[model samples]
Target: MAWLSPAFPVGGFSYSAGMESAVVEGHVGDGDGVEAWLGVLLAHGGLRNDAILLAEAHRVQGEGQSLEEIISLATALASSAERHAETTRLGEAFVKAAAAWPHPVIDVLVGPVPYGVAVGAVAAAHGVDRVDAIAAFLHAQISQYVSVAIRLGVIGQTRGVSILAASEAPILDAASSYARLDLDDLGSATIIADTLSMRHEIQYSRLFQS
Candidate 1:
């Protein structure tokens, strides 16, 4: 829980996952819209991809598999430049912070890494269960976007909680399925979310990074 907390210093708050542009473009105008949009993202897009990566990373670490190859593929799978930057930047920060606390696996990881890979590495190093780690990672991602929704005024505090509550079943189902899959299963179909992320890169005036 500590690693996934908003105060963990991963700079998650700075990235909106394209929600800012979605709000600006009027795709997500209210709490209900925010819920619907998030549902798709959680089910088919970046969140799904992240979950698969996290699960694979955890599995590899536990099985004594190669971290380098996993990191390489995870980096290449990023759907957009901003998405790549967001994961790599947060991953670098996560690795540095994990190093400070001292973990054997952390010392082995060198160079750039993806956020999901970093999370799996650290969790495995700490002997955390794969299911628990995946759940935390998904929760953190969901919370970050929900926080963005609140900041964008698309959802009130109460509404944000409601949306989260509504997401519990889907999050569990996705996490469970992803945990059982291999890295080759990684894929995303959130076109609008990806478009929003791309559009955010050149958005004239933006409140978030990506």
Candidate 2:
């Protein structure tokens, strides 16, 4: 459960998924805009990609294979400095956290793996079944994104929780369906997210690393 804690210190608060840039461009100027953006991210972009990656990672770890190749792939396909930085930084942090409270499954995952992969590994270590692990992983992301949304001052705390509550079924459904996916079926192409992350590079008034 430590991994699910918002206080786990993964630097999650630092990124706003280009919300700053969007707001500055007047694309997300109010609470409705923020809610809509959060909804899109939860349904089609952020959570979807992460859920697929983590579920695949869980299935792989559960089968007792090394995650070296997948970890490298996740990082390489990260697409932007902020994206890369977010995954690797959290990967390293997960490693350190795992070391302090060693679990055999997670101990085998001791290196830079993507956040999704590492969480899946740890969930396996803690004896969570595959589907539940993926659900938990997505749940954590929903909470984190909402937390960041709060920091963005785009919505109040109640609104953030409401957004998360509204998203629970979709995220779990995604996890259930996605957890069954094999690597061959594993892919994400959320172009707007990638573009926003790329545009984040040039945004002078940015509130996020990406």
Best by lDDT: 1
lDDT of 2 by residue, 1-210 (tens): 677677787777776656666666677766677667766765667566676777767777778888777777777767677777787778778767767666676556665677887887777666788888777777777787677667777778998778878878877787788787766764455676667777888887766785
Runs in model 2 deviating more than 4 A are: 104-111
Q: What's the CA RMSD of model 2 in angstroms?
A: 2.1
Query: Cα deviation of 144 in candidate 1 (Å)?
Result: 0.7
TM-score (C-alpha) between model 2 and the true structure: 0.88
After best superposition, candidate 2 residue 79: deviation in angstroms? 2.0
**Tens digit per residue, CA lDDT, model 1, 1-210:** 888898788899999988899999999999989888888887888888888888888878888878988899999988779989999999988888777668778877777899999999889878998878888889888888999999988889999999889888888887778888886777778888898899999999988889
